[model samples]
Target: LVASGIDTNPWCDEAKKQKKGDNKSRKDVPTDAATAAPSIKSHSDFAEDTATEDSDATKESLASSFGKIVLWMGVVAVLAALHVYMSTPLTRGQVVPPGAWLSYCGLLPFDPECENAYLNVNFEGKVIAYNSNRDVAWEMQGDVCAAQVGSCVRGLELRDNGLIFVGGKRIRSIRVPDKSVSITPWPFAEKPHLKISRK
Candidate 1:
């Protein structure tokens, strides 16, 4: 039977062909699986790395913002402390001399020297005159009583009456013969007036 069926070995030929096809399919299967698995793993690794990097960036930004907030808070606190310090009163018997710190209240005059003019300040360092011409004269010192005896001169005024009225203090009479010279008590007060003297 073997010699007669040499050209017609159907069963044996069929078996060999099946084996070759199986080997080819097996090789292709492993190759495709190997390549595909690596690609998927690479993609997943890239996604994880990106997520970690983004999280780190967000944390750093938050930290930077917190630092700036702390810095500004410190600056504001220092400014507030300085303001409180400057506004507080000095202790007992503090001495501030002439041409020293000044504060005043009341209508004085309108002039360049009068602007920001340092008027007669009480011992408490409160300004009492608006238009004070004294550079240093009658400048009160610390511990001195307010309303204590102090001298003050008014700035220039244009009145033909030959008298300048010191608000609340009485009118100062002036003998404007040549230059203007004002004398206190103005011949117009309820109390004993000061002597009218010419400068």
Candidate 2:
């Protein structure tokens, strides 16, 4: 056996086993995978998720903004239509202005053809009232005309809630519209004679 150059030591098998165990231990010490924690995600995957969320949020914001804009536009359009309608002469009753409804309108002989009918009263008087506290009480002076005559109305001395003495005639069931008469003693200070109230 010595001439063949083969040495048979009894501890040689034990040494080989120990070397294998060391190799196994080294292999058990895990690779670089220890740096990758379980909770960690790749940058590309996180960016994709973030981009998707942003896209959804942007879409929602744009939709909400667009909806608000449309709503306001509709409101503005309606208001514009109403303003135009109110400003046009259609609601003016041809000769009467806005903010008043009258009973009748009469024209004087030399009055302009297109004058505000509610502005051309032909009677004159003053309005006085009693407030119970009595100190000469409530008083207003303005001219008034009757709707009895379509051509002209007579003037007279008058008091509010009192009497109308025109040509010594007793006036009954008389109604006056606002802004359509002059309760002063003037030739043109009369009330309009239009059928504003439904009879």
lDDT of 2 at 16: 91
lDDT for each of the candidates?
0.41, 0.42
Worst 10 residues of 1 by lDDT: 182-191
How does model 1 score by TM-score? 0.32
Model 1 agreement with the true structure over 1-199: per-residue lDDT tens digits: 6777566578789999999999998877755666657645578899999999999999999999999999999998986665433333322222233233333211223434533333333434332322244443221112322354455322221123333223113333322232232211211112222233334
Clash list (residue pairs), candidate 1: 103-127, 104-127, 104-128, 105-127, 105-128
> What TM-score do all the candidates reach, one by one?
0.32, 0.31
What value does the lDDT take at residue 107 in candidate 2? 22
Candidate 2 on 34-55: residue-level lDDT in tens? 5544557789999999999999
Which segments of model 2 are wrong by more than 4 Å?
1-39, 91-199
Which one is best on lDDT?
2
Clashes of each: 5, 20
Model 1 clash tally, residue pairs: 5
